[model samples]
Target chain A: MIMLLNECKIEMIRIFRNPYFVFWSLLMPIIFYFIFTKVVDTGVDDQELWNKHFLMSIAVFSVMGSAIMTLGIRVVQERSEGWTTWIKVTPLPSSSYFIAKMVGQSAVHVFSIIVIFIAGIILNGVSMTFVEWVSSAAWILIASFPFLALGVLVGTMKRVDTASGISNIIYLALAITGGLWMPMEILPKTIQLIGSWLPAYHYGNGAWGIIRGQFPEFKSIAILTVYLLLFMVLSIYIRRKQEAV
Target chain B: METIVEINNLTKEFKGKRAVEDVSFSIKPGEVVAILGPNGAGKSTAILMMLGLLHPTSGTVSLFNQKPQEQKVRERIGVMLQQVSIMDALKVKELLALFRSYYPTPLSMEEMIRLTGMQGSELNRRTDKLSGGQKRRVSFALAMAGNPDLVFFDEPTVGMDSTARKQFWEKVRQHANAGKTVLFSTHYLQEADDVATRILLFNEGKLVADGSPASIKQRLLKKAVSFKMDGHFPKEQFLAMEHISDVSEEKGRIVIQTEDTDRVLSSLFSIEMPISDIAIDKGRLEDAFEQLTVEQGVS
Candidate 1:
């Protein structure tokens, strides 16, 4: 556990030192939230609704950025550079590698969640029940695991350039179809149905539901859980094959 | 002495093309064997298989006479691959600490730094910021951290300059003298000549020759004899000497390519002319390797 945490902390330091994170992971989400909310205003008068919508969208963005972009790029680089092979040869267990990655992503998720929630409360004058805030933060952090596993799968499949491009596309697709960009209900019915099946849709909906003081249905949790499992299995299988080769 | 690594009929094929074909060798404790081969001669492929990074298409690899992939056996094996293996994001100290986690018992950071000759604020420097020689040395340090009984060092001194290379060899000798089994691969013949207890030549994924350097050199008994001779235009006499493969005269000197030193020396004794500055040299490892490789066309 100490090793895992140390690895995660080291990863966090790298993220903090990276100049790209300043614009992309930190400032970009808030900037995008403002631009999108202003350009498309749904006829909902309550300020709290806008706050909830904006907060959830930024939270999803944070999750996408951490799991898909940062994790994907780093993993691909590590693989190409033979860092993964060295670790495999070392006395370090493989489980520690994955656990460290997830722990790192978890740290990023927490930061993203807090930043988004605090922005909503301070700037948008959003009010949330104590239970709502705690539950929403918990769910946002938990949802990072599935996305992280999916990122690991994608990262292991392709080289760094392709992984970055594919992860970005996945992030945008999830953000758009899953109601982070626009409400899924507002889209065409077929698109809405497709959006419902997306993992990001379920994850975003789960977060939004928590912030609205509503109990999340098991279906959304089950969908994210299944997708997470599939990605985890796929990542493990690909990694093993890579090692064998 | 116990044999720590045994490879039996190991073969690896890539897309139906054999890279290593039925090559078998065993390494005993405290022995250092250098695998010598030209580029694309399957040295890297063989090393990869031995390190468990690549699986053999046929046959078996045993470490400590157990499966190579077995964790218990792997725990006693240390490897430094041909490529850079450190993460750029990690500081040197952090890197050491991280790698230290992999072994049940690893050398402490102080010992690792000392072994690699790194010290004084350099320990906390990020890996990417280090020079290539420093990085290679650090990689060497990591390879030694586990204190394994068997170690694989693949092209460990490639990027090093002469001074660093000498230092690296000293460290390698220290490892072997401490009773560790080391299998290192190098293209530099002299490096092998200086340290390797035995040298194995590989060509086209096959072990073409294996023996101590002296033994291998001895196999090519054709030594070169050059002498400045005076007072005789003895051309046919020298040419007719037994065991002399070739005779040539250039600028008052007679050069003989002969396998039998005694026969040639006796023949020269009969030449009553003054023999000045006579030099006889046995074949070198490089010459023998080139001759064998060329003869076999080990491409």
Candidate 2:
């Protein structure tokens, strides 16, 4: 247990020290929040509802961006550099290694969430009860789990150079198609259909639901859970294939 | 002496091509062994199998009488692979601390720094900022951090300068003196000749020669006599001489492979061959290595 915690601490230190991770996970989300909420008006009649909706969307986008892109790209780079192979020969358990990665990514996710939330409250004049804020934060954080698994899958299967492009494409695609950038009502019918099936759509909906004082649809929660399991299994399978090779 | 490692009839095939075949050897406690081989000679493959990073197609490897993958066995062995690159974002001290946490009992931080000759700000620098040789030293320090009973280093000194290489060997010697078993693989003949108590020569995925460096050299029993022969006396004549095993020409010089250098010389004198710049050398590990690998390649 102590060793696992030590590994987690080491990974946390690495993430914080990296400038790229800091820029993408903490700073970029706040920048995006300001641009969308303060600069680009949604043209909705209910300004309060529009503010809350955009807040949830950026929060989900921030958590997914950190969990999938930053964490996944780091894993791919580490594998290419042979650090993963070095760790495999050590007495550290494989479970501990992964848990450390997740914990480290989770720290970045939390930071990204706080930055986006602060941007919503201060710059956009968004208001919410303390419980609503807490619940929305909890749901957004939980929604990042599937992206974490997707990050591992990409990290295990792709090279460092290609992994970056692939992860970025996936991150942006999920955010845009899942209606985080615009409401599903405004998007084309085909895009809405595809977005409805995506894990990000469900994750965003879950957070937005909490802010609107209603429980998220059980179907969305279930589908996100299923996607998380599938990505987790795929990541493990690809990782095993890599080790065997 | 107790046996620290044992491998029996080990073979590894990749995509139906043999990388390591029918190889076996054992190491005794306190013995420093070197796996000497050229590229594609299966040195890394065998080491990987022995470390349980790769599964052997056939045979078994036992470290401390336990399977290599077992937690108990892994805890007692430290490994530095040839292709290892440490995490670039981590400071040297942080990396060492993380590696040390993996072992049940590790060397103290001060001892590791001292052994690897790391000092002052070197330990505080991020790994990505380090020079190639400095990174190699950090990897070496991580390998020894576990205070392992048996350590495996694959071409550990490849990027090190001469001075750093010497210091590294001194540290290995110190480890052996403390009754630990050290096994390293290298293509440098002099590295094996100078450091290893026993040498394992590998060729084409097979254990071609295994013994002390002197013993392997002695078994070949062939000295090289070379001279500039001004005119071509028939090469067939030299081949027919007594005590001469083979003859080859290099850079317009005739080199005779002879077991008895004196007899070959007297025969040459009798023939009145115009010979200048005469030099005779005793058999070296390089000659034995060449002869062994070449012989294996032939048949």
Q: Largest lDDT belongs to which candidate?
A: 2
What is the per-residue lDDT of model 2 for residues A1-245, given as tens digits with 9 covering 90 to 100?
A: 99988888788888878898778766776787677667887688988888899889878877888788888898899888888878878888878998989987787677777877888888878889999998889888887889999988888855888999999999999988998888888999999999999998999999888988988889888999999999999988877787776
TM-score of chain A of each: 0.92, 0.94
lDDT of the candidates, in the order given? 0.79, 0.84
Task: Summing lDDT over every window of 10 consecutive residues in candidate 2 chain A, give the lowest-scoring window.
Answer: A24-33
lDDT value, candidate 1, whole model: 0.79
RMSD of 2: 6.3
Error of 2 at B66 (Å): 0.7
DockQ of each: 0.57, 0.71
| Interface RMSD of structure candidate 1 (Å) | 2.0
Best-fitting candidate, measured by DockQ?
Answer: 2
User: What would the per-residue lDDT of candidate 1 be over residues A64-137, giving only the tens digit for each residue?
Assistant: 77787788888898888888888777766677777777777778778877887787776666788888888888
